[model samples]
Target chain A: MICIKNFLTILVTFFLILSCVLTAQEGKALQEDSKNSLISGSRSLQFRISNNLTLTSFEGAMISAKKHFTSNSALRFGLGLDIRSGQEDYGAVEEDDNLFELELIAQYIYYTSPKAPVNLYLGTGPQFTYNRHVQDRNYEETGEDAAWQYDRSWTIGLLATFGVEWFAIENISFFCEYGASIGYQSRYMESTPYQGYQDQETTQFRLSSQTVDFGLSVYF
Target chain B: MSRLKKSVIAALLLVFGILTGTISGQNDMQTTQDQQPGPQLEHTWSFQAGISEYFTLRNFDMVSLSVKRHFSNKSALRLGTWINFWARETSQSEIKNWDGTNADTEIENRYYFAALSLQYITYLSSGKDVKCYLGIGPRIRFEYWKTTYESKSDALTRLGGDSGEIFAGLQSNLGAEYFFTDNISLIAEYGAILDFWGYSDLYNYKNELSSGFRFSLSPLPVNFGVSIYF
Candidate 1:
């Protein structure tokens, strides 16, 4: 699986780079055409709230800058912040988990036509996440004994997104995106009746999310 | 490679070939469009939420409540909190001395369990109607047992117990959605939870499989939610 994932990653990176070069060449051609001069490009900021069918709920905000390279092509770069909360159940207990995520992204958009208002975007990015788990319980049973316990952890991951943007009004537009990310986490456990267990080693667990988000943005 | 491995590899390669072919087709489309004037900009934004119920298939009956969100159309994050009510009943045989007669004894017990998790979802399809998602995350759980026993003579006894622990795990899901409107859809999902713990000679219990304990459960959950485009 790792091999396959790596292969796909390489393939995607190659294609993405190739597309950027092609788009850049197109931009140069358009610049040479006196009839079609590149218009203005600026910054766009957006906020979105989303839910997974089985994971935690997320709320995020992002600010991005776009530069038009041609009459129909542009490049965008952005930063985002997100907060997540959810709960998990073990046969013996349940704990509530909260996470904070920071991400950076770069994307290239190729406008379909001068007369149309549609563009296809391809983007890749990385995210750093901090997760804290709060285990709430009345008591813990260890065979004949009972006590209290808590758990916490932090993780990091890579993100990739592909989507399309549609502009309905002059300066306002809506966008839908699909994204996937992978992360590895480090965890710790503690107990109230006794000193918490020290660092425990486990496989680099994989954390991933797929989302379909829709939000409105205005270009400044 | 074994036959099974060979078959798996073949299937995978076939899928990859099909995907690359489709992408090449899209590239051709782009080239054709490049000859024309500049391209149009297409954009859309949306928000969605849903609620689901969880049922356990183990010896004991357990139920849970769940809620989730989707940001774009493919990435999903879910936060769920669930409470499990456990119940069991058993019968024992009692012998009466001197007379060859047997009396039946009945016993019952109940327990409470809860779990919380943060999960990330990834969708593989480009289209919204048919989509597959993969998810994984960490989970914390608390379990408590309350037992009440009744004897033939109408005697009652109570046993109180509780346990709390946090485990790391992976979550994977496959789902499909049908849209009745552009902004609203019905979703059905199936997924499983895998939990892992360390090997501890001091903490090992007879009921546990080994010094290292791991457990899995499949929660087939379904929900109906509304998606609003921004």
Candidate 2:
């Protein structure tokens, strides 16, 4: 029964979004009489800080290229790099770790206005991410000799986002976004020669993330 | 001939209706073309950090620090990293025999396991706003164990060992994100680790009606974070 109800809710939501898009398109058509313009472009850059710095937080840089096909329609491509560091508290054991991420994104956007200072946009795209991390202490009892070591890995996945940007000042805007992505990662550790035994360990790990972010974008 | 033809036509119609109904139901749930404002390009990037808590049979507490990045618009890619810290407390006990003889035993065990992995992710539509991503890739795991035993006769022994192994497997993640604005969104994800290569190891046990250990160290991870797009 719960599944059925959820299914129905989803169906309704999809239709609602579709209708909104259609209506927005119609509105754009009606405004065509004013001035049908094409080929408008903009570039933007932004930075973000995570709220839970103890777990994860960083400063990142991004560059976006957008092409407007119609007054209110466009497509966008983005590239970004982030460097973050934080501590992991293992209840009884704790370690500080750092990570670096680089990504490339492509998306389709539907905008509410071409000339309006504030516009709403929704987009989804494919992202390729490369991630690497290092830890200070391996969480083991036998001191540094029996401690674990860390390594880096790279993976690919899909990402989606919806948000709005408000141009509070000319060529400058504040934007907020919500998005999620799913991907996989491989992680392993090597043990040094201990006593008379050679030790080895490895495991396959999964990676996924959901986030809400706010930042300032400078457009040129 | 006429009766047989009617029956055949009726069966065909029944099958067609069922198939169409299923397809329409799925389409209705997933079709979001209506939400698209116009033919526009939209790109969003996000990063999330969270802590994971693990519970094993022995009640050892492990802390995990994880980082994730996501891009959403068309096909998506996600990258994440996690480091885990494992710990435990010492136990002491005494037992009595039928003859009134008592035996004292103290056992102390401490260990930690650190794992890292990279995965390729794909999303299966759950609804307009909810989706599940299946991730497959390789993982590296390291385990270090230390044990101390004490007897009533003042005999003490200490032993410790460490092991490292790498395996390839499937990782599954399910989650949902709610968009409050076109650029800002909140998300939650739950992930499961599935091991295939590790199943054949000597320490692997299969109690869940399978060939290998029914359960090994399957990590259940959950994360929440915020995302922004440029």
Candidate 3:
């Protein structure tokens, strides 16, 4: 836990410095008309750093890329991984108990204005997810240690978002979006945690979004 | 022909017609990977990456990526590399007392591999819109595998170990590719893989076939990718 805090503190501090640098472009060559004229027919690539960095205690990074299809439209894709651990019981002999979640998203975006200093866009797309929980336990009374796990799920659902972006400079922008996602999971499974042991299974519906995401984009 | 036979023949014809339309519509361009975004007619260069899932049950998987520079429609020089990582954890239960209660034992194993290959690729039929490339070359790989076992029953026991092996061998394959656009293509290839059994001397597992060479088919033939020409 201490490690996770320190990591986040350092990352936030680093981004603070980067934000200061990007903000210093206020008096630079960026004009309101420059923003609009560049939006139509021109192509740009974007790099983003987002919420996944501090979203969980497990500690992971989320990065996204967007390729402009036209001045007012683009596509964004992102993937994030979290590998968190817990000794479900401190008394258990085996220590590396873990839960894993992987999230993937592809979104389509359309902007309201092609040539504006600020742009409003509506985005929607499909989100894919895989989550699993596992642990190992030792029964001292029976002189045996067994590995067990409950509920692994793979799910897909539609996600929609509405957002605004301020092109702080000619090629860099900061944006935030409010989104919701709900989807069905094909299987919810439980087993002994052995590589191939199967025990129980069920169907499920997954509500797996945080409702809001804010990030920065640098395009070239 | 009888009415039933005529209906059956018509259904078969419809299926074949749909198949042909789909295939031609998605002509997945496989021209020279070097076909740059220009008016030039040369199909000379390509870059490809592939994902493999042939051994999921064995807890193993791999990714393969490659690039080729074609000198002519018939031949080219290629460089490719791929990485693989596999891990498995399982257990054994001891029913020593023949009771419903038990002691559980566990084992965990992990391995990673990276390979580098260089080869000369030759086209047997380099048609303008469709083609197949055949290649054979020397390949080398770096492998690291590790295993750990833990038992916490009557007598708490924990054990762990690892092994590393470097590999060298020859690989050959035949693949067909089609170009659908100026800069995109879909390709499928399959053929003999490297001689993995040659390492029998290190593990002492293949003494029966020491005097004879062994061959195995490459596991994937359905890898798709985009090509950029320069």
Candidate 4:
């Protein structure tokens, strides 16, 4: 819910700024030859930041690229990964932990104003994410039992995105996007200490933006 | 066909139709300008000093200093450095045994980190006062941390250790600079990092070694800084 609120706040702020810009130029014709206009065959590399600002911590970053099929349409693909592992040992206790995560996104984007300095776009894509964590604990004391645990989860979904892009300078643009998703998720957990385990799967329909994506793209 | 299937097909067709219309219209509007922006800043040097996570209003965990030499309007070389130092102290009193006698414990932790990065930056586009650049480079980092615990009442309860790490990695930075003036600009950058780290721990005069790699796919711009050019 907090994520949704932050995304809405940013959305409102963007529209307010957009309205002001429009109001200031209400009577004048916008320059037709924008220095940052898109054309067919254009390609771009982008670094996207996913954050729920002031609500949650910084989520992560994704590297993505886009290839324009036409002046108004494009295809984009993104990839992200994270890995961590650590170990600790004291006189009486020893433990080890590891984590791995991967995410991928592919989208088809249709720009509503490809020729304008500011482009409004609608995109739809399929996304996949997977993560796993494992831990092991051992006690040196007599009659103490060792514990092993692991948790794993994966999700695959389709996402629809609404976004706006502003060309701050020629060949470079800044964008903020919001997304909604419908997907299926599977989770499994096992712990040996108490013989506790869980396995669950479900379908998810989410409209609230889990992440607010802000990105900078350099067009080639 | 099912209603959902029909709808999906119709939507795809509509999108394709719009794409076709726009492509044809673009042919009449003249192709996009291929001309590059006129020469702006070249053969110049710049220096920047800033803090990371500036909005948190917390302790300065990460401080940065960097220098850049522009070879041309389209490219440059930059060397950046960052350092972090953090210390924490805690004192607590607790009951350790069935006799219910109070025991006092003091704990102190210190951490230090430093990194140096060398990058080659390419300007994708520069216009007037705003420009965007892509930088990719190698970085070297060192970290040291120590913790000490003292429990005067219970000798067996005291436990802490020290560790150190060295990291070598490649990082790619995507960022934009908004020039506030001809010589000063504001920068916001996000980095995609790949790191290989080696770790060592010292306990009871024994050393242990561990190694790992980390890769982050997407990230927010944690670095915001101001730069001055000469």
True interface contacts reproduced, per candidate = 0.00, 0.00, 0.00, 0.11
lDDT at residue A27 of model 4 (Cα atoms): 31
Which pairs clash in model 4?
A60-B218, A60-B219, A61-B217, A61-B218, A61-B219, A62-B217, A62-B218
Ranking by TM-score: 4, 3, 2, 1
Candidate 1 docking: what grade? Answer: incorrect
Error of 3 at A178 (Å): 2.5
Number of the top lDDT candidate: 4
**Each model: TM-score of chain B?**
0.41, 0.40, 0.48, 0.56
Query: For residues A1-220, what per-residue lDDT tens digits would candidate 1 score against the true structure?
Result: 7657656655665566567756876776554442221244533433332243232212222344456676466665554443444444343543444444454555565555533445556655555544444444321244332334545556666666666666554334567778777777676666655545534444376756686866544343
Classify candidate 3 by CAPRI docking class.
incorrect
TM-score, every prediction: 0.29, 0.29, 0.34, 0.61
Assess each prediction's global lDDT (C-alpha) against the native.
0.48, 0.47, 0.56, 0.69
Could you give the candidate ranking by lDDT, starting with the highest?
Answer: 4, 3, 1, 2
For residues B35-154, what per-residue lDDT tens digits would candidate 2 score against the true structure? 554211134444443322221111111224333344444335555444555566555544454445555666555656566565555544322322334455555555545445555633
Q: Write the per-residue lDDT of candidate 4 for residues A1-220, one digit (tens) a residue.
A: 6556655655565566556655654533356335564678776766543342211112234456688989899988776677767665554666677888888888999999887778999999888899998887778565254778888889888889888989876567878888888888877777784665444444455544556678777575
Give the per-residue lDDT digits (tens) of candidate 3, residues B173-226. 555454555566544444344444222112222112111122322222222334
lDDT of 3 at B49: 48
| DockQ for candidate 3, C-alpha atoms | 0.01
In model 3 chain A, where is the ten-residue run with the lowest total lDDT?
A52-61
Model 3 residue A202 lDDT? 65
Question: Best candidate per TM-score, number?
Answer: 4
- Which segments of model 3 are wrong by more than 4 Å? A1-60, A83-92, A95-99, A138-143, A186-210, B1-230
